[model samples]
Target: MSGADQHIHIEWRGGTCRVKWWSGEYLDNGRKRYESKGGFTDEEVAFNHGRDKLYEIRHGTHVKNRDGATPMSDWLDDWLAAMDHGHLTERGYRSTVENHIRPYFKKQNASVADIDVLAYRAFKKHINAKMKKASSAANIMMVLGMVLDDAVPRLIKTSPVERTRRRGKFVKKPKERKKDMTPQAVEQLACNARTVFGQAGYVFIWTMAMTGMRPAELFGLTREYCYPNWPLSDPRPDDEETERYEEDVERYGRGDNLMPAIRVERQVQYADSTLQFFPPKYESCRSLVVPDFLAELLKDLLASHDHKWVFPALKGGSLGAVNFDYKYWRDVADGADERSGPRTRGARPAIPPVPSFKGRRLYLLRHGHKAWLDEDGHSKFATESRMGHEVPGVEGVYSSVTVPMERAIMKTLQERWDRLRGGSSGSDA
Candidate 1:
């Protein structure tokens, strides 16, 4: 071997060895090699030691024939695409790729292999930066582990991610965000929405704060589903007008719906052209819910309009964050939607500021609901149910739904939201 980069030549001389240095990682025999930290005692020892080192450095560890070698970038792409027909949820597959996985790895080469602790640390720093949040960065690690694990029998001899996932000194979730949204702050937002967005928009914001439902739930809500005149189990609506429409809803969605029994159940996401409902996070399936007032408000939001879908969704109520699609509504934090209104002579209460706009993710609303429910003395289990947390058990088995106080809970919630929205004192409401 000659020249000067990081290369070594190993000559077998019985027990003694000869080694020569050159550039690059390949050996004289067309195989890959590595360098040793210390020189060998004999010429033969030097050749054998250097050869082993070269293999270790290139393929990582003392392994032979590093087959299926590809860059991390290529592997991730294959992993994400592979999720298409797999059991993973659309939200899990798509978003795990987008928000956490892809952003950090989009540029990595597909042919590279053998990552060490040092490389991982540096890579983490770079990825942590691109990630929008610390939890998001953590999620990236998780998704990467899953993707690599799926490749266990395929490309990888063993997952580099297994070590990466358990690496030293984990970064804690940032405490600065203060994921709490107070009642007063909620009211302020509502006031701002009413002043800027008028009735429709303000109501939309209020519904999210009160319900704990994702934005899509509000948007995809249809008039027919919540206000159906059928019995709770009966799918059909009433034949006659019945005693009253509002009373029937109040008894169900507003009444029994708040029973403190909840589950994440299912999720709706847009795919191809239409909306599809699937198991929620962890493939959880069931009805996630909150106090009855939310049930009532949701029901009311549906009842007041003739639209079939909950929010202003097109193409049969596409799922996920609907606001993310509408640039006009999206400009709420930026006040970009500011235009001369008939009532006011100025732009609408436009985007407040960059910091303010950044504060309004779907999780923010969920956090706010958490503070509200906790203040109201709701149990942690109930709250978890509202969030669609899955109960642990043996998988590849039957699944069930369970919620104890589903109706009476609604009674309390309805009372609370009326006061919150109507500007009345709701100590118990």
Candidate 2:
């Protein structure tokens, strides 16, 4: 074919062919672009490859050429440095790179292009061999995907994670099943916490159960954000509570039964023995309504403490989960069992002496809160907001939290509080 009619030109070397083609368009600056691909056994195959490359560039599907020869470790370091640190905690970033990414990639000296789906499969197998959690494995895979995706055309042509179909259905691994706690168990645990760790633990456990706040968010709470009688932000900051309450009534059309609310905007995390405060997970900044009883308790608790932290450590600093769990939660959880009684002198407590669920975690209280909200028929939007989770899909976009919904949540929490106190039912506010 003539050069004008032929989109691709091919030339044969000893055993291979080289193909060249115009990208078929002028760039925005009126510059012509061409492409070349080689190493095909036949001229036709080389031509087809060149033609496909031209089409990709023309269609804006081409990955721009960048440095692809960097080692996986070096690439990861650069990528991590360039990442939006706000999106994840420093610990999370370090954990993924150290515990997951490097361990899998460092063993191989191969470039990014040499890593394929089989490499990923082997990495997953290695993680599984170590008995890692399914969720942890999944997260590692996700991080790898992110790296490979960003490495396109520069480091690798396409992602090597296989997305194959079986019988017209997409293949997917089953997620790990997290245990959920019941509201009754939550109440019992909270009471046990009170007895074991004093009033601080009691209020902390109850707040988690009632508000569905993440442990980090709960720890991040400050008195200024806890509006026991009004919204976190009064439209008129200079105005009195009565004036702001009246404004809320007019704006939100709320009635007399308004409960307390907490603003969730920050979280505290410990990385490398350093305590740092950051934005809430997924940046899910929102307000949560609390029961009147909880509000009163929180007010009293805040009044008693002179520190900025709502739940300060015993020695007056940030409370770390590791210390909290070992010192207080383990003992309280053990004491919840009827089988666990007074310890004998000079004897170690019976290992697993409690017949009851001895391994109750603080997070289970958050799960219990969500369950209670579901049981009380709170709107999905309100529940997700309270739980610090973004509602998925169109419903999330359309639905919003309303005063009535908040009122209903407060009413249910109040009812649960009464029931916990051995009352038959709760009276309407």
Q: List model 2 lDDT by residue over 265-290, tens digit each.
A: 67888755677777798878776777
lDDT of 1 by residue, 1-429 (tens): 422223666555555455754323577899755333334457656755655545554555433334456666676667666666523454566776676555555555443344444455666677788878877777777666677666554455566663534568878855645534645455555555555434444555666776576654555544444433222432334456354344333444434332322223345666665566554545433343445544444555556655554454333333344544353234443334446767855555444433333445545766777676677776556565565565455431344323444443455556666666677642211
- Score every model by TM-score: 0.55, 0.71
Instruction: For model 2, state the Cα shift of residue 29 in Å.
Output: 21
RMSD after CA superposition, every candidate: 10.2, 6.7
> TM-score of the candidate numbered 2?
0.71
Runs with alpha carbons beyond 4 Å of true place in candidate 1: 1-78, 81-173, 179-203, 228-266, 273-275, 283-285, 288-300, 313-322, 325-338, 341-359, 391-404, 418-429
Query: What Cα-based lDDT does every candidate model obtain?
Result: 0.51, 0.69
Query: How accurate locally is residue 345 in candidate 1, as Cα lDDT from 0 to 100?
Result: 51
